[model samples]
Target: MNTTPTIDVPVQVLSGPTVLIEYAGLRILTDPTFDEPGEYPVMPGYAMTKTSGSPLGTDEVGRIDAVLLSHDEHDDNLDRSGRAFLPRVPVVFTTISGAGRLGGNAKGLAFWDEATLTAPDGTVVTVTGLPARHGPEGSEPVSGDVVGFLLTAPGHPSVYVSGDNASLDYVQQIADRCAPIDTAILFIGGVRHKPMLDAQLVTIDNTQATWIARALQARRVIPAHFEGWAHFQGTREDLTRTFEEAGLADRLTYA
Candidate 1:
């Protein structure tokens, strides 16, 4: 048996879906949204309200080696300031459609597609795109395309970042393909938009997050996108309660 030291990666949740992941001497930012709390119009009457500002500002974030953007169409994921910040990053990995829409250092990957990036210490990190759905089965037409991400390195534990998925079936598929995920960063908000689809959830809720943790058998579960927005129906307390009830509270991590 080959024994290698496991590299511990540090994940810091700034706000909402924006997180700073430090691994292999590299800083990776996810779904950068630094705009102040305000109302962002999505459709004619539909608007997404931001309730909180990111703890860290773009200037404080310093240099970002790469970005793992699930999708860019929504302001909650990538706000006005985030769009402006993308051009500065060295590389950005997002959905194929989003890439096409956003050129310039932006690369798109289909589900299961992989990309390799070299860290400052010459460590090669393999990032693979995973499947995700923003809404119900037939909601893609209006919901657009979203993608999750998986990170793997030689000595680092594998990490899964679920962007905006709502379906448990998709989670099952991910579990079957990539079981025993060491760290799982799930986007939970239970977002609802009545004008769009009768207030159906646009992302996973607390119960689903608990199920996802059990399915993946994740060593660490960090929930994001559960707060800082008006549309989100779920909260960190809800997730904590669910995980506690499931006897998996030890696995939950706020940062």
Candidate 2:
């Protein structure tokens, strides 16, 4: 019997854009929003009071090695419950302003700074923070500081977690910093509602996501930030068809 080796890189979709990546036995939670009833609101599109997806209570998740905040403004990425659980964990990595906001709860990692987060097997993993553009181009007032992460494991596949962003230039920049990427999780949602059809308002719709994924030359492209809210317009089917049409079906991987 040919036994297939189990790829231990486990990824659990907690909610909307939130995910738990268990790589090398290290449990890393990205953009955790575990609020019940999903009360926190982000932008005009996304909000959560919890009870949206899997019920991941604090006890159920066990211990988390590190928490990646990316940017602290969005509720989808940051929630009250997640914020409350900050001091409980050993290390919390995010922006300086966000940490200050936490009030002794967690520490902040400056943008582009690299830190070693211990793995489950005692091996150290390197996490690099990359820049991200939130909201529209040339519109910094409404848009906040969004960041991405490069999770690197020596001799293993490295992953890029694209927080809520849509700019192709930002995607290209991430690729420039970390080329030959093994995997990339792009936040793909065409989030559109009444009276807001302008390109400046909506982030990575189907077209933009496809372009960025292809530009990154990622071995595997995973789509996130959809299906858990009513405001998010993009769907898995939309991604599937787009990738297929772009001739990147082989490269695209849907969660």
Model 2, 1-255: lDDT tens per residue?
011122335677777777788766788888777766545554476443333754587668887878877767767677767767767777777776667777564666665888887776777788887777666676545656677788876655777888877667777877676776767777777764333335454357877777877677677777777667666775678778888998888877655
* Residue pairs of candidate 1 with colliding backbone atoms: none
- How many Å off is the CA of 155 in candidate 2? 1.7
TM-score result, candidate 2? 0.85
Question: In model 2, how large is the Cα lDDT of residue 162?
Answer: 82
Tens-place lDDT per residue, model 1, 1-255, is: 111225446998887899899867789999999999999988887788999999888889988999999999999999999999999999999999999999999999999999999998899999999999999889988999999999888778888899988878988988998888888999998887889867788899888888999998788899888889898885677778889999999989999
Which candidate gets the maximum TM-score versus the true structure? 1
TM-score of each: 0.96, 0.85
Q: After superposition, which runs of candidate 2 have C-alpha atoms over 4 Å from their true positions?
A: 1-8, 38-51, 192-202
Which runs of model 1 end up more than 4 angstroms from their true locations?
Answer: 1-7
